[model samples]
Target chain A: MELLGIMLAVLGAALAAGFAGSGSAIGVGIAGEAGAGVMTEDPGKFGLVLLLQALPGTQGIYGLLTAFFAILKVGIIGGEPVSVNVWQGLGVMFACLPIAIAGYYSGIAQGKTSAACIQLISKRPEETGKAVILPAMVETYAVLALLMSIILLNSISF
Target chain B: MTLETGYGYAVSRLRAMELRILGKSLFQRLLESDDFKDAIKTLGETHYAKWLSDDKGTQNFEYAISMELQEAYDEVDRFTPDKELSQLCRLPYDIHNVKVLIKGQILKQKGSKKRTDLLTKLGNVPIDDLILAVESEDYRLLPFGLHRVVPESLMLWEQTHDILSVETLLDSHLFLTMRQLVQKVGYKGVEAWVHAKIDSENVRNILRLRRTGMDAGRAIEFLHDGGWISKEKVLSLLSEPVEGWNRILGFADVSRVFEGVPETGNVDDLVSDIEKALDNYITDVLRPYRYSTFAPENILTYLWSKEIESKNVRIILVGIANGVDKESLRRLLRNVQ
Candidate 1:
């Protein structure tokens, strides 16, 4: 029974991190690609786009951290015996959900901002600060997800 | 309270105000005007005309815009009742007031220029009084009586007299205020957006300072105290030749458009470009969202959209008045996203 619980925990962590991080990776790539398009047209907004692309990357980090903690709980770190009930497994799964969902949508939004930032740069390169700001505005949700997940995990007993 | 009730009211109001934003035709028409007065006349035909025609028309326009912003903000407050949102809306007014006072003082030092252009009575300390006040007070790192500068900003400002330093202090304060507000509200979304804007603005300011033959030290002094670009990088950037636009451009891929500016040109255009860029950013980008069942997104969006319209009108009014060529005037009109 304990071994089964351990397996569930490990799998859950891997799945959570893998799926959510992948979404973030894809999202950041999309935003970066849009930024690249803008750069090609005007080349001056590189810094602003970099910041925008980076905002989406935070989602991936949140996923990875959650998965790492799950793995530790399952004793993946020291090879100690691990135990988890179904409730714990469910907790892990739900905790990872926010990043996966928010990351996917934020990536698309960030991509659109990257395109706009490019247009902005082409016309008024001096205001790249505002361009960097637009996409960061979307990533707040992912950060909130990471924070909430951490709190949730802390509340649960293994 | 239900999330629907909390979010519904503000979002609906924002959407309605959003509809009133200047469409492309107005931008195009104003762009076609020969000068600022012509542009102002055209603008007078819009909803903004009554305010523009007041005895102190310019001040009236500024106040009317502030009132419009306040109305949009009130809608947000009605829905969410967030104190931070109130503070956010009021911040620009606070800063504008300070800037006006400071500029007025600076000019007074050089002998008074007309104080009419500055927005006073918006709780902007009277220019003469502000000068007397700053002169009497001990200049702390950030200086006393600064409504916003926290300890860090005070430190930075105390260290440098460069305008960039003052800017850095303000930027830092803005970020600090924003971050704390986000944490307090448990709303990370708005915080991220605010930080990105600060970073972008920082990079732009650095380039502007550098282009104007200002040193990194001066830039640091003027650098808005908070941003992603560390002071060290700015120092190195200042050492580069004016022709080294590519080096600055390399810092962020989004900033590549800055490289397109003519190698030989007035720095004023760069300042205008930065202003226009910020305006487009607030209006065109950022999807609105609900957080903690409050409508921060709607409030900020409405506030920013209104600001862009007012700025566009101002551009038109000034252009038409100057009798500038229609083609040139059009090109000068900032794209308000």
Candidate 2:
């Protein structure tokens, strides 16, 4: 039973890193395709397009941070393993759900937003600052999800 | 949502390409060019520079523009996710090739080369394949939906032996085919654009038939379907005088074109003016898509704008070669920018 508790906590960390990283990969890929297309016509706009293509990557970093905090709370990295009750283990897993689900979806949404912004910049190069701001707006949800997961993980008395 | 993403890359590239298109200021410069050589020099600075340099003289200007148009079509075809959607823009060119080939065949037996050089090399259908299909009467070589029109047009020609009848049959088929393609693509904007084009063509046909003294019943035969204007409206307009056109069209720009012109003046010039007015109206209708980001309408608008630019260039160069005054040539050009 105690083994099951430790396994569940590890699973929570894995889900956070795995799901969010996958989402970022997809989001970055979508934006990269659009950026490459624009670059094909005018290579001079590379700096602007590259910046737009990187906007969806923040979610992955947030997810990784959450996973690291969860692993550290459980003492799974280097210290002696902390024996957690099933309730505490389940609590940690539940805490990860916010970032896992939100990061996965928001990454895709931000990717689509960034791709559109790249298209806008392609047409009006002078509007690159405005284009960057549009996709960054989608980052707000991912940040909120990260905050929820961090607060929940810290409050749990594992 | 998934479908819009499918076109993301293509639309992005098109947005970049749109920047290179000639603008109003460029047209102004071209209009003010001193003479034929000066006009060619003006074109030399635009995207036409490479094509113009290769030709050396303005004699091959039409051929160069045609090549550029083909390249543009090819670029769109290469990028679009749906091949049929891209082919939608090429339908007019395919229909045009069909007309030329059929006419050439009919005129061949009479030993005339009237339309030999009129065939454009810029369609989804290859010129050689279209020629062969016309010769063999096997339309499988043509695009998917266009096969039946060729045989039916030939049959209509056989029955009436009237060139105008054959042309009317082919034109009606072309518009119907365009409507079907737009429906298949499922874009409301493109459908509206197609309907507007049909309405404009219908109005022009009505005016031409009325001016030529053709009976209203006969004029109805050439009227195309799928326009916003009903056939009944066109039928009523056919019986009315040319001065009443402005009242029926209801578009201020179009009405303004017909307001001051005398009814008894030169019919050719009047007809040309009306055609220019319709072209300007269509250009105005397409202008909104200039800012469109992801819709296929942007691609359609760009293609139409490129064709208008090509036509305007041809008009200026041909006018200069013929020593037609700039003011008279300016009257015929559409406000593309």
Candidate 3:
């Protein structure tokens, strides 16, 4: 029963990495499908389309960073686990929720935007700058959530 | 809600293909061409060169443009995962073939030579297969319930031999299937377009009945099943004069289509103008969907654009061949945009 706190923390970390990574996978996949279609017609746009397809992949990185921080706080990476109280453990778990939830949803939203941008480039390759900017707009919320999770994780004391 | 944004790959591919569709400038160039051969030469420079490069000569421009339209249909069918949307677009061609085949068989039986050249190859069903099915009177191999429509259409034509009746039945079958597919697709844009189309057909029917001195009962009885304006509303418009139709229909913006309609303008020349106007109205109904990201309606819009492009090219080529004036030819082009 005393190990429940760490268990919850681990579950929180898993959720942060798992759902966010899943979101990125879906987002990147959608963008890739669109990219392939564009490239099928004009293979010259491969470099630009590849960049658009990579836009949705950032959420997975943010989620992994958040998970790594949580693991570091628990000292799990050092093979010496911290003696965290139930409250601190709950605090850590809750802190991870921001990135977990935000990354999961924002990543998919960014992917749709990226796909739209890919289509834009297909039509007007000169507008690649605008295409990149549109999907980047969806990244702001994910960055905020990552920052929030980090600040909250720092405040929790063992 | 999930169905709203699923067509990412198909829509993107279609956007790329749309770049190949002849735009306004190319249409202008074709119009400026000195003659039919010059128009064909100009087309040879575009992606349409695939067929023209073979040196089929200028006389086969109809065959070349028709092939382009067929490619658009086949490509949409191949790219889209949504079978119903593709079927909705392809069904008209199938029904057209069925109508021709049924009439051909009937005419051949009565010692008249059937015009095989009129059979369209753009339908989902192969022309030969559809021909065999219709000739044998066994439709088990047909799709989209064409089996039912085939025998029924043939029976109507055989009993009455009224070409109009056979064609109307085939069209109703086409529109009714379109209505059902629209419901199944559950996309609001498609529903809006189909309703507008049905409404336009209904409005034209009642107006034509009143114009041709035919009984209003025929239109009311044969009115299409699905439309935004009610059948009762269309019935009410039957008694109203041509000028009052715009107000009674509740869509005042469409008053322009009826502008030149005289109280008794029954000439076939003017009929095409009103038909073009109403068709433009329907195309305008779907114009908003062109901006959609991943909806199937976007692909449908591209298909319409392609069809319009093909029609305009055909108009220009045929007009140039016959020495028609530019302004007069321009009047015949569909204002789909």
Candidate 4:
């Protein structure tokens, strides 16, 4: 039963990292395609397009951080194994749910936003700052999810 | 093939290219220029500058324009993964070249001067292949249904000895092909535009037949199928008197075109006026796509707009060279702005 509790906790960490990472990969790939297209026509706007392309990558980092924290608290990395009850293990997995769901969706949404911004900047290079702000706004929800997961993980008695 | 999300990059690239398209003001500048040379000089200052050099005269401007159009089509072809989607735009040119080649071959048999110079090099089928197909009478090299249509058109011509019949046959085939392409693309806006275009062409054919004192029954034979309006409806509409046409087709802008024509009006003038009205109507139909962002409609609309721009430029250049009046040229040009 204690082994089951540790396995569930590990599963929670895996879901948080796996879901968010895949979402970021898809988002960044979409943005990169748009960036490459823009660069083909106007090579001078590379810096601005690159900035937009990198916007969706934040969710992956947030997801990884959450997974790292969960693994550390569960003592899967470096520390001695902590015996956890089934309910406590389930609690840790539940804590990751916010970031796992939010990060996955937000990453994809931010990618579409970034792609649109890249298109805008291609037409009007002077508006790069304004374009950056639009996609960055989508990142707020992702950050909030990360914050919620971190607070939940921290508050839980291991 | 399903249109994938891969269009993101191509659509963005098209959006950027849209900015470089010549506006009404630029065309106005070309029209207002004092003479042919002045107009040429003005055009040289535009995006057309690369194609124009000091030695290239107004006589070669048509060739230059054709080359530019071919380049634009090639660029669009390179951008899209679906070759058939891009080929849809070039189908008309292919049909046109085939018509010219076949006609030229027939004319050559009579020992006339071959007018191959008039054939455009802007189609999907190479000029050499078109020539070979026409000369050999085996059209396996031609794409779409033209391989069958070419020989069948020739055989029909031999029986009827009517060039107009042959022309009508080829036109119907062309529109049929276009309709199939639009259906395949599945873009509602483009499909609608193509349907409207076919209906307009039918209207024009009917009106032309009426002008020439041809019967409604004979006019129906020339009408192309696959338009928004049914053949039965077209036949019923054609049976009405000329003045009554306005009442039947009043919803279309084309109805207004037939309103003011005098009984003794010149055929050439009437045809030109009708052509202008149809051109303007088609342009209006496609105008909504100007705001469309990522769909195939944007690409289709851009290509249409570019073709119209090319036509307007040609009209201005040719009008200037021939000393055509500014007001008349303006009346003839389609508004792309």
TM-score of each: 0.52, 0.88, 0.92, 0.89
The Cα error of candidate 3 at residue B48, in Å, is 1.6
Query: Model 1: per-residue lDDT, tens digit, B1-337?
Result: 1212333324433443455568779888777766555665666776666566776655445565555555545555554545565556455555555555555555666687836356643332344454454555433423223633533343454465455555555646555666666666654555655654665666566667666788555566555534445556545656676456457646643244445444436667655655455445444444445222124555665565665666666666555565656665555555543
Better of 2 and 3 by lDDT: 3
Give residue B129's lDDT in candidate 2 (0 to 100): 85
Per-model TM-score (chain A alone): 0.82, 0.97, 0.96, 0.97
Q: Which consecutive 10 residues in model 1 chain B have the weakest lDDT in total? A: B1-10
**True-vs-predicted CA distance for residue B113, candidate 1, Å:** 9.3
Q: Candidate 1 vs candidate 3: which has greater TM-score? A: 3
Off by over 4 Å in 1: A1-158, B1-5, B34-38, B58-80, B102-117, B120-175, B234-236, B239-271, B278-295
TM-score, predicted candidate 1 vs. hidden true structure:
0.52
Please identify model 4 stretches exceeding 4 Å from their true place.
A78-81, B1-4, B54-58, B235-274, B280-293
Error of 4 at B127 (Å): 0.8
The interface root-mean-square deviations, each candidate in sequence, come to 13.3, 1.3, 1.3, 1.5
Instruction: Give a tens-digit lDDT track for model 4, residues A42-104.
Output: 788888988999999999999999999888988989798888878878888988888898888
Could you say which candidate leads in TM-score?
3
Instruction: Give lDDT tens digits, candidate 3, residues A88-150.
Output: 778888999999989988888888889889999999999999999999999999999999999
Q: If both were scored by DockQ, which would come out higher, candidate 2 or candidate 3?
A: 3
Question: What is candidate 3's TM-score against the reference?
Answer: 0.92
